[model samples]
Target: MKNQEGHDNSMNTLNRTTVSLLTCVVLFASFAYAQGEYGANDFRIKVDARGQVASFHDAVHRRERLVPTQPAPLVAVKKGDKTEEPSRAEFEKEPPLIRLHYEDCGVSLDIAVQETESHVSFEIIRAEPSDKVDAVIWGTVSCDHQQDGG
Candidate 1:
């Protein structure tokens, strides 16, 4: 009876260990699929195309998502003529840039994005220099989250 009890205890321990390991793997995979990844070396980033920057990860940090809530780089395009904003053209689309032509006002903002190993950058180039300034577009990013990717 003593030997049987010892064997049962060992089995219980193994079962608990297996369950715990499985739970961890499932959780990690879930975290991974929650975002789409893009990177330039260590400057890896994730964006979900929800008018937000989804995550940013690096070597110094575990494989955790740095941005989990709120839209990132809130971009707003305004036209002096009160023209409606263009519908949903992603910053992550096939090419990471947008060109807005305001023929009504004779101006445009040629916006470009440059992502690097340590930085995600954007550039707004005027199609031509003009005080006519038909529209303005901008963004803001804020996150200080710490979650172990492991």
Candidate 2:
């Protein structure tokens, strides 16, 4: 009887450890792929942690335009002949803005977004150390072939 009780306690400890490990895995997964969705009017955008546009949905057309897993990245800054992409991205929900930080080049780009009944627009409102920034390049977006009827 004592041996049986000891075995039960060991099993319980193992089960608790497994559960704790699983919980940590779930938390890490969520953090690693964290993304934000923002929309106004008929356009919706999903931006991932690496400052990539994971999804671009146009509600009126019933279409998704951007391929999230393509080799292309979003919002890069060109310094001289070298181009640096955002190492991280932060978003603001109130006015619909995304700030892309190019840590390597010490530059940041603030993109302001606006939507009307029939149109959506994006403008670069600010670029820190503008002298260091030669150009801000938005990444190439690949069309969804199915949506394109290709």
Candidate 3:
């Protein structure tokens, strides 16, 4: 009876230790994913005709031009019977600008590139449907242009 009680206590200790270890591992993994690295050389941006956006891993240079060459269509206004085109700055400041379709969520999101850094920082400035808020997603980039084929 004494030996059996000792063995049961030992098993309980082992089970507790295993559970603690698993809990620690799960917390660490969640933290890691939340602070994951996303950088210019590490990911690629996709923009569709309707302005929907997406991102993917950039395996190859795929060095296509960054933006379309043609100017975006301008809105014309008639003021006192005189027609005028919207100014360049007006077009530049448009928001909800790039729509993004989230395949997993079955919901579309709008995104904006807030900032780009050569070395350690990059930020996704905005996302929309407005529900997601203006949280910034930042990560490090391998700024070694030579090594990265930049």
Candidate 4:
């Protein structure tokens, strides 16, 4: 009986390990495929499945734009308990009115990025309603650079 019990425990452990490994592999694959890029004339943006503007480039301006200061979107949940934002995401679709999903609090954040020749828009739609929903934009800051007078 003792030997049988030991075998059962070992099997349980093995099963858990296998499940965890598979989950990691699946998550990695989803994020890998979820990333996308789009361009409307001179303006272009790269988006990750985790609902972040990974990078933005303006070719006509001759310089890149927007550094990612936050690892992911700022969010606050139930009782102000912050949920761990997903670092990667599963892509919903491709360019020009692209959609991305971020899983949190038993709900999915359906983020949409729409673009036109000269305009861009973003919206976050909740798949399931919950009181624990708070998302904030990571904005941009400008600084004036100067040098010592000659």
Candidate 5:
């Protein structure tokens, strides 16, 4: 009886420990995904949790082009008249991709990020529920001019 009771207590302790570890992992993952930065050469871009461009910087030029507080998204799906942007975004480093999720529209957009010596490019590789999508809006960016009086 004594051994059985001890074993049961040990099992309960183990279960509690497991649950605590799993909770920590989830919290850490969320914190990590809160923001992401991608860069190459003289350019860098930081994306917020909602997948909006938080910062577009040119190191050589010393300029930040995107308005971090702007409500406009870098990409939006126009379904009929409503423009739906991603409610959440996760960044993946391997092959470089930003996975955007639109919960209301029940769709996902995968934007591929490609960087070169001179520039960075973003291309939408996949858009789910293509039929429901009317148009893709790029951006209404509030930015500083890259150059003066050109």
Candidate 6:
């Protein structure tokens, strides 16, 4: 009788362990699905230029451009917390171009600028999945450097 009781208790413990593992798996799957949905959302780009040539390396990429001191409308998309605005020195080195590269959940973005007396243009490119290698984004910047007496 004692042996039988021990066996039954062991069996119940095993059953509970299996159920717990299954629950964990289900929760993990749901989390992954949510992340995928969020990633699929669109992102936007907004550039504020100082009306001069600027150069700055993004955390992940490198670029150069010329831009004006004023801000310009570049692109519209989803917003992310990781995005950062370029510094004055960075903008002066290039022509107001922003490049974003994502791989294995890692992201690298570069912003450059071009400046003119009358106008400035900015570009932004993004690669998605962010954690994977299947996403890619590209674009360009247009500025009126002629007006800046360049």
lDDT tens readout by residue for model 1, 1-150: 225556667677789999999999976544333334556665566555343455666646645445556455434445565643323323324346544445445555555667676666757754544566555555445556555565
User: Over the stretch 16-37, how does candidate 5's per-residue lDDT look in tens digits?
Assistant: 9999999999765654667668
Sort by TM-score, best first: what order? 5, 2, 4, 1, 3, 6
The residue pairs that clash in candidate 2, if any, are none
- lDDT tens digits, residues 34-80, model 4? 66676677777676666566767766664566554644342222325
User: Candidate 3's residue-wise lDDT over 1-150, tens digit each?
Assistant: 226556667677789999999999976544232112223643444433323222333446544323343332212223244433223210112221333334322334333334244322322343334452323222111222334434
The global C-alpha lDDT for each of the candidates, from Candidate 1 onward, is 0.53, 0.76, 0.35, 0.53, 0.79, 0.34
Instruction: Give the alpha carbon lDDT tens digit for every residue of 1-150 in model 6.
Output: 225556667677789999999999976543232111001112212333321222221212222222435343232222343422222211222223444333324444443434444334344333343353332222234433332221
Show where candidate 1 strays beyond 4 Å. 1-38, 78-87, 91-110, 126-137, 145-150
Instruction: Assess the local accuracy of residue 62 in candidate 6 as a C-alpha lDDT between 0 and 100.
Output: 24
Q: Indicate the TM-score of model 6.
A: 0.23
**TM-score, each model?**
0.41, 0.65, 0.26, 0.51, 0.71, 0.23
Off by over 4 Å in 3: 1-7, 33-61, 64-150
* lDDT comparison, 1 vs 6, better candidate: 1
RMSD of each: 17.4, 8.8, 16.4, 9.6, 4.1, 16.7
User: Candidate 1: deviation at residue 58, Å?
Assistant: 3.3
* Per-residue lDDT of candidate 2, residues 26-49 (tens digit): 765543446667676777877787
As a whole number from 0 to 100, the lDDT of residue 11 in candidate 2 is 70
Which segments of model 6 are wrong by more than 4 Å? Answer: 1-7, 34-150
For model 1 the local lDDT of residue 55 reads 66
Off by over 4 Å in 2: 1-34, 40-42, 58-63, 147-150
Off by over 4 Å in 4: 1-32, 68-84, 94-104, 134-150
